[model samples]
Target: MEQTEITEILNRPYARELLGRDLTRLAYVAADGTPRAVPIAFTWNGAQIVLCTTRNSPKLPSLRRNPQVALTIDTEVHPPKILLIRGRAELDDVDGIPEEYLQMNGSYRMSAEQRVEWEAEVRSLYDGMVRIVITPTWVKLIDFETTLPSAVEELVRQRAERQNA
Candidate 1:
């Protein structure tokens, strides 16, 4: 898709809402040549989607081997609103927790005291982390109202042609 088209899709209100969501299913090819999609917390900066993981994370090796990835951020409601993204993962190994990691998990409901405790625990747990950054090269939004899955859209077109016939 053209960059402008991708940007237009990402700028839609529903797409923006999905991006604001706490978790996205990150899909990638594992080292064993199998597909894996795991739900992980993420933060979408206007241009890129950022995910953080422990330094020793297994997925890191898989991602390093095959940087191509897809992400799905969707709602659980009927006629789910889904934003699909395709990009290449860029791993940045950092010495300490990235601020984006803190921001991504900040949406969880917690008391001020619990929040403080949680941060402390996180700080103590990981000596460093790997930041996975993906800048969307392609994007799509499906609300099932104005848009739909490609197969469904094709079926709709076939039905219309039959009616015309």
Candidate 2:
């Protein structure tokens, strides 16, 4: 999709709500060519979606080989709000705990002391991290208002035609 179209979709209120969320299901091609989807913490940095992983993560190799990926951020409530994105993953290896990781995880509900301890633990555990940055090539927001599922949209059209007939 065109960048302007994508920006319009992403700027919608429903899309903004989904983007505020901390988790998304990251779908990618596994090393053996199978498809895999895993829940991961992500942050939208205006232009790109950022995901952090251990430097030695197995998925890194797969991502490096095939950067194409899809991500879904959705709500569990009835008539769920979903933001779907298709993007290319770009991996960047950083020397220390990535600030993006910290920023993405900053919303976790924790006490002041717990937050400090957690940060300390994270700092000590991983020598470095890989930031998987994804710039969306296509985007969709399904809020059942301005947008609906494909089947539902078709049904709505058919119903309207019948009513007119």
Candidate 3:
């Protein structure tokens, strides 16, 4: 898709809302050439989606083997709002917790004491983590009001044509 098309899709209000969501499913090709999809917390930092994971995560090797990935952020509802993105993943190893990780989990209702405990646990768990940063190459936003799945849209059009005929 053209950059203009991708920008339009990503810029939609519904798409922006989805990007603000806390979780997105990241899909990538596994090292053995199979597809793998996993739910992960992420943050949209204006330019890219940033996700943090342990250095020994199973997905890391696969990502190294195949950087091309797709991300889906959607809600479970009658007419779901979905933001679909295709991107290339780049791994960045960092020494400390990334700010995005904290921001993404900030919505959770945690008491002051609970928050401290959580932070301490996180600090002790890993010495370093890998940030999987994805810069989208293509994007599509599907909100029931503005867009539907291509197959369903086609079906609706076909039915209307038959009725007219």
The TM-score, computed over Cα atoms with residue i paired to residue i, of candidate 3 is 0.94
lDDT of each: 0.96, 0.95, 0.90
Estimate the TM-score for candidate 2: 0.96
Native-to-model Cα distance after best TM-score fit, residue 102 in candidate 2, in Å: 0.6
Q: Summarize candidate 3's per-residue lDDT along 33-69 as a digit string, tens digits.
A: 8898999999998889999999999999999988999
Query: After superposing candidate 3, which stretches have Cα over 4 Å from the reference?
Result: none
Residue 157, model 3: lDDT of 99
Model 2 lDDT on a 0 to 1 scale: 0.95
- Cα miss at 17, model 1 (Å)? 0.5
In the range 73-155, model 1's lDDT, one tens digit per residue, is 99999989999999999999998889999999999999999999999999999999999999999998999999999999999
Better of 1 and 3 by TM-score: 1
Check candidate 2 and list the clashing pairs: none
Clashes of 3: 0
lDDT score, residue 53, model 1? 97
Task: Give the range where candidate 1 is weakest over 10 consecutive residues by summed lDDT.
Answer: 93-102
Per lDDT, the best of the predicted structures is: 1
